[model samples]
Target: MSKIALFGPTALELFGHTVHAPLQRRAITSERAAEFTPSKRVLDHVHSTFPFLSRPAHITVFDRKHRRQKYARCHLGTPALLNFDFLHVGDGILAPPPEVALVQAMRGRSVIQAAAQGSALCASYSLHADSPTIIQREPIATRASLEMVTRSCSSIPGCKTVRNALPWILPHAASPREIALGLVLFLPVRLGGYGLPRPTLNFPIPTGKHPGNLADRRYYVADLCWPHAHLIVEYDSDAFHLTSDQHYHDIVKRTTLESMGYHVITVSRRQLNDPSEMDKVAACIAKALQKEWRFRVRDFPTRQTQLWTILGLAPNR
Candidate 1:
């Protein structure tokens, strides 16, 4: 078992697929390649159980040549060595840290796709570490991580778009819908989203001047909040917020938010799912924002975006 560091999609899937699953199989092994070698029994067992694994395991040697690459060095963080016979190609191999693997996987993808994937990954798991790649780690650092992947992306030949989209990905998103709402609101209007100012997810705002102690305080946690704009957007999914009690609570919450001088906007699954309807909804949001927005944040145009603009990524607003 020669230790090696595996990365890319396979590593991301391996590291995160079962982070909280009941049957976690990932295990730590020898820190150095010279210290470990797979036994015959281990190899046989892995071969036998390979078919039943959630995903096929693939491993590769992390050679010195790779370490010199800028992206490789910037993206690859602390790696953990593991033993799973199927993942071993020839001998001792290790895997890149989860963050490293994710950045490696983002290579060659479109900006929209990469941003969506990165933000979704953030929502699904914690990817932050004290590693140099990330600064000011998010609260959910226990769930997913972030690092200099954005900077690394910028240095890559075709990753300018990915680099520009980096600021849009949020580590605080709690669900896929929330991530989508962020994309729809921050992605340039040409991309079919509203191009509104980026907002905070699951933002808590106090309802009263002194909302009791922290434990007893009343808060209206908006799905998305633009505090400066004094606006909140709530994705009212039928599956979760359609109950009578939830509905009543929502009515009261909206009233309270309005009383607090915050404009409340409710979005539904139906409108988000349809292009024409989504556009209308976005228009309504634009109107609201126009009324209150003293300043707005739009995607900063990058070289890739300038080229995209010329190529018709979206018409100038």
Candidate 2:
């Protein structure tokens, strides 16, 4: 049996040799080692088992100059090597020529930066690997809902006239209603009076009379015309509801909107698991519509205007 004698000056080297020698010899040729150091397969195995290694790591090894000079000159804080493997392409090697080591370190830093940015982007868009490219491409419930809404809208008694007249009438309607219609029509899921199994409604109501007033506005604006009749739906998650301030703010906003005639309906994190929440929300909306229209026809009043003011409007007044 041929035995290999692997020697290193430090504990890290000794450990590396003991753990990596076999895999390095098997995967990489001695000739290849002359040009570029071979990566140990064992490192790949370890990284796969511990996915956390994808995180940034700062490592320093003694320079080859110190190794050759027999400790004649020792430098502190000067890295001999910096090993980083963001792609998990085996254990990285950065030896000699501080410039090379610096370059490798920067590359590693860039990988971490890119990863953090990618994570932020994915989180912001609620992107998922399994999401469909198009509404019709989605699973049965989603496809059915969209088809039903489109078919129903097209088949309405005077749909063509309504669609043709929409461009003109839309501009005259309240900004909130216009925004709500746009959001519903363009949303990934079907919404608005759609008699589908699971329907969602979104309100993209406008805020502020001027740009400056837009700052720090409420999360949502309600349509006061049919306050209790209109449902304000929210998609909640641990991330959004994490802080006490956030929770309190949401509560206050919901209460204010409710006071103005809107019925705020919250969808819990777990409720999204069952598709029936869609139908439940829709039913609640239908029932609310049966009540009297509380929103004033003339114009939406300020917060100080009581509901009584609208109710007292005389037929000719």
Candidate 3:
């Protein structure tokens, strides 16, 4: 048997999928993998149960008591404070708790990458690197959970970055695109933020009755809303074109919001792809909020490019 090995992205990935459903970790292919690694029997059982684990480029081992020069790292602080957990992957792998794993994964990542991933962690979705890339429904972790972990692991790598990102992570993000949209809009200007105020995600407001519904619902939820500004931004996806019912429902919601004296802006993938169009949306937001539209940072253009590049909005990067 090898010593208990595994941490970092592997652990984050492990807990991430587990948040949705139990999954197995990839096997360690060596004898000297660690001081006390998961036994082959445990690995075999997990592989037989879940045969498809991601094979990382390198193996990672974590020592709760000591550190090694190459593969293993000394655990940060205490296990109790870190809230370390384990998975069935050979029964000895260290699967850091969702919150801790999330912050640890942020080590050396750029602000946008860290913030985007942090938001996704708190979101009711799971983003994957492979096909079907995003799973939307269950929230794997939350800002408050991450905050608790970071507070205890303050000296750990990436904890500060995660702490800086907490204020921007909203709750109940419905889709990957929504997460991207929110970050691009609300992150601080220093981090490629558009200087927009924080808006509640899927915020519900009383809009009185609408004829489009059988229930004559008196409230409608806005995709991204600034209550004080009375403005809402909705991402209009292609689904509306294919689903008449959804389209009609959205139309009614927009009409209701508009009738209630609120300014509404509908953003689409097409508009997002067009640089000038996004600027126009930002302008609309500024006008609604009654704020001057200006970039305070000296290297605003460079930071903006870096932000989009990290967010994957840069096509040529």
Query: Each model's C-alpha lDDT?
Result: 0.52, 0.29, 0.65
lDDT of 1 by residue, 2-89 (tens): 3334446655544433333222223443444423333344334433433232233333332333333322222232233232312432
Which ranges of candidate 3 are over 4 A from the true structure?
1-6, 14-54, 57-60, 63-83, 87-94, 127-136, 206-219, 239-241, 315-317
Best by TM-score: 3
For candidate 2, write residues 157-212 as lDDT tens digits. Answer: 22233222222111111222222222222222211212212122334443324433
Candidate 1 lDDT for residue 230: 90
Candidate number that wins on TM-score, 1 or 3: 3
Write candidate 3's Cα lDDT for 1-317 as tens digits: 44454455655655444436335433333333344433445445434443445543112443443443333343433333323433444444435456766666788876577677777666776655345556665776777887888888876688888888788787777776787778878887888668788878878887655454332366887888998888899988665465777767877777777877789998898766555567788888888888788888998667777777777674322
Q: Tell me the lDDT of candidate 3.
A: 0.65
Q: Look at candidate 1 and tell me the lDDT of residue 285.
A: 77
**Model 1: how far is 160 from its true place, Å?**
5.0
Error of 1 at 6 (Å): 4.2
Residue 268 error, candidate 1, Å: 1.0
Query: Residue 242: error of model 3 in Å?
Result: 2.6
What's the ranking of the predictions by TM-score, best on top?
3, 1, 2
